[model samples]
Target: MHEMAIAEGVLDIALDYAKQNDAKCIREIGLLIGDMSGVVVDSLTFSFDMIAKGTLAEGAEIKVKHVPLVGRCTKCGKDFRIEHYDFWCPECKDGVLKIVSGREMQVEYLEVD
Candidate 1:
């Protein structure tokens, strides 16, 4: 699964940061995951846990914040949350909805000691 690769990336970042900071342990990691990012949180967490063993990031808490997909109407200039993949503007039936956010997957913060 692609989640494994993503986990590896996360671990690499954590380790690199810890080394740079001279931290002996990594306590937590905060992530911002979007609805359109296509990352399964459970799978990603599991993969991270599996790979973090015996490392500075071992036993670290992975905190995830969910970001909803928001879109803007191309014609009416209205912004709204897109539910169920609907791409039509509610204010104007003729307006097409363009994505404004919710396509991101990134590490936000790290807690280390």
Candidate 2:
């Protein structure tokens, strides 16, 4: 699955950082995944576990933070959290919504020792 590639990329970055810092092992990996990022948490975690074998992050804990989708109404200038995938603004009814957030997948930080 695509999660395997994502996991491998994450591992490469983490490993590179750890090596640069002379870390013996990785303790934790903090991830920020947006609702619209399309990265499955369980699948990504499983892939990471599988790929981390015999590496600095072999036993590292993965912490995931989910970011909700937010949008701003173009007509009413109102900002709201999107519950469903509807692009219509709830307050203005006729306004088109511009997505503000929730399309990101990023590694926030890593804990290494």
Candidate 3:
């Protein structure tokens, strides 16, 4: 699964940062995952736990903030959450919605000790 790869990447980042900062252990990892990113939170977490067993990041808490798909209407200047892949503006049907957020997966922060 791609989640395994993603988890590996995350662990690498955490470990690299901890090593650079002279941290003995990693406490937490903050992640921002968009709805359209297609990353499964549970699978990612499980994969991370499995791979982190012998690392400094073992038992580290993974804090995830789910980001919803948001779009802005070009004609109506309305910003709204896009549901079911709908691209039409709710207020102005003539305007097409442009993606404002979502489709992202990134590590926001890491707590180390």
lDDT of 1 by residue, 10-55 (tens): 9999999999999999999999999999999999999999999999
Question: Which residue runs of candidate 1 sit more than 4 Å off their true CA positions?
Answer: none
Candidate 2 residue-wise lDDT at 32? 91
Q: Please, what are the lDDT tens digits per residue for candidate 2 over residues 1-113?
A: 97898899899989999999999999999999889989999999999999999999999999999999999999999998998688888887878888888988889999999
TM-score ranking, best first: 1, 2, 3
lDDT minimum window of 10 residues, candidate 1:
90-99
TM-score of 1: 0.94
- The Cα local distance difference test for each model comes to 0.95, 0.92, 0.95
lDDT of 3 by residue, 1-113 (tens): 99999999999999999999999999999999999999999999999999999999999999999899999999989999999988889897879778888988999999999
Model 2 misplacement above 4 A: none
lDDT of 1: 0.95
Which candidate has the top score in TM-score? 1
| Candidate topping lDDT | 3
Displacement of the residue 54 alpha carbon in candidate 2, Å: 1.0
- Position 55, candidate 1: lDDT: 99
